[model samples]
Target: MQSNHDGKKPGLPEIVEILAVSVCFTYISGGEAVGAVGLLIAYATLRWGRS
Candidate 1:
């Protein structure tokens, strides 16, 4: 049987959920440019980590 906490990283849906929240908060608190930069940075970090 598979365990719930098998030490696996979050899947795409989970990552997207997090990204959505982060972007929303940043956009509301900061602005469009800041939100865009934050998204770019997040995407870069995820890609870098995957490689």
Candidate 2:
């Protein structure tokens, strides 16, 4: 069966938004390393959801 999605990848704006939020949380939590890991997980989740 074929999917109905347009197959368009996420744009720069979406990525920037994710990065901005991640950095903000990192600053708030005072742990750059943990924040970076969380960012990667969040980005991966977003990509997986899109696909």
Candidate 3:
């Protein structure tokens, strides 16, 4: 955001654009789902780590 601006404070439009982009990115990437999957994989590995 700060870098997006040319050293000037961003107004409402800039803020909205940034938020919209972030929301879209999170949605497209499945956001917290990836984190949950990673945690599950880690737990399974640790629990069945004898292999």
Candidate 4:
């Protein structure tokens, strides 16, 4: 199965948005230290990838 079956699409960064939101939500909903760290890492990844 090819990764792109539809038209052109934004790839990894767009997918990371979902992960980032998930991490943030987990952190907000009482997730522990690991979850918080995940959230922080998500932000850093997004920022780093954007630039």
Please list the Cα RMSD from the true structure of every candidate, rounded to 1 decimal place.
Answer: 6.3, 5.5, 14.5, 7.4
- lDDT (C-alpha) at residue 12 in model 4: 87
Q: For model 2, how does the per-residue alpha-carbon lDDT over 10-46 read when each residue is reduced to its tens digit?
A: 5676578677867776777687778776776777577
Off by over 4 Å in 1: 1-6, 32-51
| Model 1 poorest 10 in a row by lDDT | 1-10
- Clashes per candidate, residues 3 or more apart or on different chains: 0, 0, 0, 0
Using all chains and alpha carbons, the TM-scores for the candidates as numbered come to 0.42, 0.48, 0.46, 0.37
Query: What would the per-residue lDDT of candidate 1 be over residues 1-51, giving only the tens digit for each residue?
Result: 433434467678657866786777667757676767677567646753442
- Between candidates 3 and 4, name the one with more favorable TM-score: 3
Candidate 1 structure lDDT: 0.63
Residue-wise C-alpha lDDT for candidate 4, range 1-51, written one tens digit per residue: 345525445478656866677677676959876777677666656644433
For each candidate in the order shown, give its overall lDDT on alpha carbons: 0.63, 0.67, 0.54, 0.63
Ranking according to TM-score, highest score first:
2, 3, 1, 4
TM-score of 1: 0.42
